[model samples]
Structures are given as C-alpha cells and as structure tokens.
Target: MVPSPVEMFRDLPKKVCPECGEYIEEQAESYMMECDRCLANKEE
Candidate 1:
C-alpha cells in the first residue's frame, strides 16, 4: 500500500541550512541549498 503524503513527508530527513545551522523548510519542487536569510546576506 502507498503511504499518504503526510506520512511520506514525515519520513524524510530534516533539511538544515549548512550556512547558518537553521532548519530549512521543505519545498515540493525547489533547488534552494540554503535558507533565505543566509542567501540574502550572501548577495549583499
């Protein structure tokens, strides 16, 4: 039997930002490697 979306999501590893040690939110379709705050700071 296939697992529900929530169950599948719960089983996935937590995504953390390597730059600032912050917990990154998961996106269904994203290529972001770092948290927004850090990324913004990096661009300055």
Candidate 2:
C-alpha cells in the first residue's frame, strides 16, 4: 500500500486573496503558498 504524503509543515497564517477566495499564508514562500482553485500572480 502507498503511504499518504505527510504534511511536514505547521499551519501558516491564512488570509483569503481578494482576487480569489483561497487561503494564503501571511509569509508564504513560492514552494509553500499557492491557490488551488484559481491562477493569480504570486505576491513578491
């Protein structure tokens, strides 16, 4: 049986993006933060 990918990181601070109703971490890195539902420019 395949093992489920364990979530390695702790929960980040969440705030919904104005453009998309997706939770985003306050201090999100490129690898860590992204929207699952809609494509939007990641804040730099």
Candidate 3:
C-alpha cells in the first residue's frame, strides 16, 4: 500500500457502514465509501 492511500483511508470519517455498521477498507483512491459486501449489494 502506498503511504498516501493508506493515509487517506485512515483519515476517512466514513469508516464504518452506515446501514450495517460493518468495518471496511479502501479498495482504490476513488472507491465509494462502502465495504466489499455492501458495495457488491449496491451493484446488484
């Protein structure tokens, strides 16, 4: 992981899922603030 992305992810106030309160991680620099499971559900 790059220092910047990690820093950015760490700084996000949008860490836990609003709907489910599950913990999540950053997938990309521009990824929506969603967990893997929630993101997949969103795509469906």
Provide C-alpha RMSD values for all models, in order. Answer: 2.3, 9.2, 6.2
- State residue 2's C-alpha deviation in candidate 2, in Å: 49
Q: How far in Å is the alpha carbon of 7 misplaced in model 1?
A: 4.6
The better-scoring model by TM-score among 1 and 2 is 1
Best lDDT goes to which candidate? Answer: 1
lDDT at residue 38 of model 2 (Cα atoms):
48
Writing each residue's lDDT as its tens digit, candidate 2 over 1-44 gives: 75444542334345675566678655535544446444435432
- With a 3 Å backbone cut-off (N, CA, C), the pairs that clash in candidate 1 are none
The whole-model lDDT of each prediction reads: 0.91, 0.51, 0.72
lDDT, candidate 3, residue 23? 75
TM-score per model over all chains: 0.70, 0.28, 0.45
Tell me the tens digit of each residue's lDDT in model 3 across 14-35: 5687767887765666555666
Ranking by lDDT: 1, 3, 2
Regions of model 2 farther than 4 Å from truth? 1-13, 28-44
Model 2 TM: 0.28
